[model samples]
Target: MSAALKIEEEREWKQEQKQERISPVTFTTDRTSSGATVYNVNRDYITHINVNLSPGCASPEAMDQMFKHIHATYSTPSLSVTRLPRTCEPPSDQITTTYLAVDPLYNSAILSIAEVRAMIGILQIMMVNPMLCSSQYLPETLADLKRTMTLMELAIRAYRHTDLVHSLSRAISIGVEQCRGLLEELTLNLASYRHSLASGALNLTRKYVWARAGQGSTMDALDYKLRKSHSSFAACLLALGYAAWPELKRGQLGKDTLDELAKFYVELEQESTSLRHIKVDTVIVQDHLGRDLPVPMIFCTSSQDFHVVIAGFCSGLAGDVLIQRGNYRILNAGDQVIDPKDFGTLFEPGMAVTMSILFYEKVEERQGIEGYSCPRCQHVNSRCTGWVTCAKCNGSFKISPEESIVSPETEQHADTDFIPNERSLFRKISISKYAPTSRRAAAAAASPAIANMAPSEPLKTENALSDGGVGDVALDVDDIELDEANMVEMNANTADVGFGEETYGMPFYIREKGTTNYLTSNGCRRAEGTQIIVHPRKNDFEKSAQVFYIDSYGALYHAASGLAVDIVDDVPCLRQLRPVSGRPNPWSHPLPEFSFINSQIRVKFLSDPAFPSCTDDLYPNGSWATKTFLLASNNEKDFHVHPISDFSRWIPTSDMEDSLSYDPKKRSEKTLRVLVERRTKDVGGARTSWEIVPK
Candidate 1:
């Protein structure tokens, strides 16, 4: 936007203006009052992923544990790729022979780019998504993926959170995190190739070719560039490795053939850096002093209508950008215009935001398969959306993508990647940003104070019924079936038991969708140290939790604690309060007779419309604490407790479609989908939705 800026300097700004375009088609829909239309604000082109995670726990420590589990279980992270030689070439004649040993690497690097694209950008896509890491990775890539995933799974397994959704989410998240390295590594490879190839051109020109004032020198420079920058095996054979093309056209090879090859390589290099790669001075850091830090960084001149990002740098061009006022526009990264949801998807609601320019230099190498040739499929410049399925062995690969170019042992120099140990993860847990998106703050406006009790002398079973709650008797958990259509609902019958019955028996775990943790308990003890917690599934998690529901008033009696979670205040922990003959306790919303949500039950205690808001208070401390309800026993000594409330839910352990067992190794084609909502109202579109694959 600066008036005195060079046309190339202003190119990025102009390019962004061209990218802000209108779509081919538009549709209109009614807006909702519950919240904004967060689903499709990116318009028709962008995709949406919503996680309606709301945790249920009384203790701040317990809440913290659940949140920690959610992040630990499901999060994506950026990974650094293998480092390479930094001795890049400059445009000038100054050449450093000190890096001569790394010269052959220039040829290897160009081939490396092609191979990465063939693997990830091509063949790998034929595996599953062919775009993400998993069983789809080439054998070598698969080994790396397994290392990362095994660590993630081992981390979650060591904990006691038992929610089905969390387990699946954590598994998929690990794949996403590891897959990031693939694209990043590709970019780095291209950067190295660009630098070395340019350097090779400069070196070839200096050693050969005469410095004549006129004719041959210009042709020599062009010929040197083609033989180095974009040279393939075919090009080398055509020029016979000649640095000067004087042997080209008028000398020996036809002029049109040499001229055409020269023009092609130059155009390819220009198109490669079509997007500007700019680096800013250190003054503009991504910080909190005064700038919007959560959103994707944008670049533009103060006066330009468009925006751009520092994609990569060229020491040769001396920061020069390729610009022709491009013929068409782009949707930019993520294929969407700048919007608030991009940042909202990152941080918590109401977190302060500041907008400012970014200072770091952005760089990218050609990582995608759009322009690379596929080795197996013999496809030229494969344009598949991350795909190149094979004909014989399907998508199987016998070699690693890196090894295809040059095996690790064959390389002149190599850098090793850092591997993490499982034991170290237990001592220090680290979860990334994406994990929190599936969870929401469980704090309310006013939290009831739970009383802290001291450990009392152990009590006998006879005294357990002193609270006048229903006594818990042993029941067969296996009697429960994954199929809801054949099973009898609590309201199925009459005088003996069923729909109008006074009491109904059910055994299940209440899982928090956001944290993927379960409501756990160690039963109630008469001692002062008896309090419950709401957290994750661990090695010794209680599988049989028999809950007695008093149908008339919704009194949820915990079989383990022999006490009902009251909707009362002044209780420090979830179980501090006892049930009385007062207002109905927490309620349960039964799923309608819909075949889709067969055996699902939603239990919401906090934030229920029938109850007054007194769960959270802006305590003097900078933290917001809210009262939570769950079945737990006090243990200031690593005590585990079960979370109870309307927010908690229980479904069959089997796949949602009943097509496979919960622990089966194979996946079924049928989708195991579950519908969730903030309230148990009409079965319309809910704010949250989830899919479960028990395996």
Candidate 2:
């Protein structure tokens, strides 16, 4: 095996051992218990050189001698240092934590070209002391360092632009050559010293060579490694950043580099593949093609969420008949569309389920300056939105729209005609007929209830299994147990009460429990059936109205002013329920109003009361709940619930694999703690606890 492979294997073995030896630990709500401390880490000092030449110590005549010494000691194109009189103080808050050096002199010290470049990059963003940059008493040695820094900065900038790839590559080549030349010079000088020792001009040749050679060789090896790693990282960044450019196709990279990159790419692909399974809840459709038809398959992956669409046929027919039956050609990996029935036998019941939905793409034409054509869909438009609509089928949707995009709840009647009928194409199966009558029956059965619940919604809510509710066979006990801890926690004894006040503006209230009265934000009150304690700001009923108690399911139904009820349980309940007298209705029109339980909490829509309820009680069949919540929005399209699975896939940069794997013990000794505080309007008000912890 290659040396690289050997090193990697050994590293993996060490990591496994390390993981096995570590014990599991947890953090509680309390401020302090047991954990690594962040405060213990110490900052290193950064040295600043002040070149002051005095008449008695070093006169103007000694300038030439100083220059000779600097030239002989430091290997560089030039030698100079900026020197201005100023006290050296530590870095302050103006500096960003990202660029802060772990240690000023030792750990983060610049010993070679790679370190120099990295340090310059970091320092560029920092608020530097003006005295450090000024050349009031500039040393000659610092001038060369400045020159090198300037070149590196320019190279990095050029590398960022679209048209400077070739130039950047050439610059890197030159830098590598310069490094090689420096190493050769050091080697030659060492040989000369050895020759002097042989002539008895130098004493202790072995020790001298051992000391110098050891330091030089070690530094050289480190420099080389750093440069190589940086180069590889840069190349990857460039490739991924400009992947859409046609010029950067696979052929652009030279053979050896391409081979190395391909390996890296394959590794990334594997990682993404693993992540994809963890990130999505995909349904497996068996016999996707007709029994006699040969279906072409193309499997690809991306960093975003998307739906898969397949096309199949019920019977062999010509183009027009095929179109009428909603049977289209099957497009394969190579983009070739073939007859759906030509390659298969008659599709039997459960042969395959084919449907159409918008697939995800990487480019958006509508947003691009000069609309770029999508490589996935081959369509050109204004913005590169990274979504496409099937021109042939008229199915249009973004593959992965930004999280902020508003998706309003669809009116129940709006697309009734468009709903696909599975029974029309597949063998008619009675899901309800086969459903189990008891919990045990449900657990062991493989009936239609399982199929209905598996693809539509998640099987369990926060406390389904714990509550001993049985509905669909797809409902797993494990999933219910996993979600039980997250179930909503609310005060159960609170009775439904009315506070005749306008809900449009912020409402404040005080509820008396026992002898203590607790002042709380009316915003915290949700659910119709529960009576909430409200402390009115004013006693005038004409100005401030009493809040009313509505039914509860953790949703607050309030009759407020300026609010128009659009869809209440899929019905216009505005005309049905009017606000009680003494209640200042601030809603746009008199309508039944409801509040979201919490700003952070989202709930899923189960069914529309106006329509026949779906026979299957469980909607989804996963370990996590499938629920949707209405996000804050003025438009109907603003409310949509993302699947829990999709939400989990969005791991932030701070939670990347490396960051996640890094144990706190491995970090510097900085102990972090959580602090609890209580806030209230009065000095001796009822206490509500809040905790603060390190991010």
Candidate 3:
């Protein structure tokens, strides 16, 4: 081995040993844990010592004296370092390092206040710079950048507190302007797309709008290729931008803005990847950005513009002004308030302002009949006027003259015997008292004779004797006895009548002067021999009072109050009763059974014809007399025959008894009489004397 090579090896071996023995200590400057430098401490201590050590211990400022003592102690050397290594060499050039030390005594020695303050200032600046940039160092880089700007502002405020107010205001204004500029750019893009679509260029409009929204910068070659391979990549980017910045909402591309955008990706038919269809209508850009944006430009599509404007109106946005346009007069939802001049700009001539206009026009075309004419009187008029009188017939009508005016009176008279005289009859009976009494007595006296005659018997019997005759009259006592025996047998064979059963007999007759009258048990008066005068002023058959007749069987028959005779001078006749074995007697009419329940009178009548005949008599003219009677058993103390010429005045004998009982605890007779009278009056008839009789 050569000397040179050995020397080189030795040097290398020494270098290796040196590398292994290198010290591990390294020194670097940093902020003190208490955020103050040693120089600052020393300076404060020196100032304190100078003030207190100069004999001020007993002064009024004793605290200041104690502080001075502390200062003196800190100013003096507490410990000292004599020597330190000057320089160090790298053993193998593997890494570089530095070391430092200070003489403890000198470092602790008194420092000038100015030098201390200067060092403190450096430390403060260092501390604040890191805080100002802390936002940059946080986890989210973009957010941190924003925060860094805010922190820098705070730093400026803290450092120069008085000047910060005006500076911060200016910075904020600048930030707002920047945001506004960006928003304006977005609005322009939206408007451009809308204009293109309105110009009938759908394809170009979509390409330009989507490209501007999705690629903030034109796509790189690789990015374009990747987007083509997975078109969803571009859509996702566009959605992200729209979410982050509400301004991007204007660039959504499609003619049917909401529908087209929703189907944009789906219509592309790129099925090789997983991507959700984006619904533009449902997409909420403003919500993501936490700011409200102007109405989206995509809504300006010709069809969508009208809908959006109408909807705005319905939502109560400037509705009054928006609805004023003649074209958009029929206000609906989504309408926008634009000047009439601006409305022309929104739509071209020949295009309908709204579909609603057609509907309104159709409604305006229908016209209903406004006037009517009377059919009967030929009166032409407007308005129903509720009721009117015919000019020709003087008949009242409810129908409008234009539609149908009818004379109901003439029509009723044609169909029925409803004479005007009947109405007047009600008023005549209401005033007259004598008409009722004579009617009832005549009915009662004739009932017995009427019941004895057969219904088929001739109204008159013939007399064969001459006016002058001389003859030998012979009486056959056997014949008289046989006739009497036959009469007794007939009376014994007569059927007994019950409350709900019938008796039969022939009607009887009566003769007055040269005229004969036929009276039926059913209370019909038939004049056979002579005419009975019917007073023109008094004969109102319909309003004539009713009269009830009691037959031998004790059943009632009803008769009309007015006499049915044409001769007013003739006296009326009473009829005789005749018994029939099997047939029902008209005089034995059943009375209605009635009781008071819950303050209302409830009546039950026998519906079967096998029951006693009802006092319903029909005259030749078709007017009938009806008698309704209430028969009650509970209150009956005794039976009584009550003659009532007016059916309306007849009251139940039981109700009268209930009222007239002597017992105080029972119903009072006065109350009963009063109630009966009231009830009789309600029925509208005149009553005769009531005769108490044994049942």
Q: Estimate each model's TM-score.
A: 0.16, 0.19, 0.12
Backbone clash total for model 1 is 54
Please report, in order, the local distance difference test score of every candidate based on alpha carbons. Answer: 0.26, 0.28, 0.26
Candidate 2 contains a number of clashing pairs equal to 82
Tens-digit per-residue lDDT, 2-71, candidate 3:
9999999999778656644644432211222211112222212211111212112245367546545444
The TM-score leader among the candidates is 2
lDDT of 3 at 421: 32
After superposition, which runs of candidate 3 have C-alpha atoms over 4 Å from their true positions? 1-357, 360-364, 367-695
Which digits, one per residue and each the tens of the lDDT, describe model 2 over residues 1-695? 69999999999778656644544332121122211112111122112111222113345357557645533433221233221112235544331111111111111112334544444343333213221122222222223233433343433332232223322332333343344343344345434544445545233544565466563454355345444434433333333322322222336434644454455444445433322322121222322222332221111110000011222122232222223333222333332332332122122222333322221211222344354333234355444343344343322223223211111221221123232332123211111001112332333332334445544454532223546874434455443322222121212111112211232223332233222222212222222211122232343341222222222212223333211222222222112222111111111111222332212112222121111232432223311112232212111221111222322343333324322321111111111111111111211222221111111
Winner on TM-score (1 vs 2): 2
RMSD of each: 34.4, 29.6, 50.8
| Order by TM-score, highest first | 2, 1, 3
- Summarize candidate 1's per-residue lDDT along 169-284 as a digit string, tens digits: 22223223223334455444333433443443644533342233222343343334322222222221221112122212222334544564455444334433421221211112
Q: Roughly what TM-score does model 3 have, to 2 decimal places?
A: 0.12
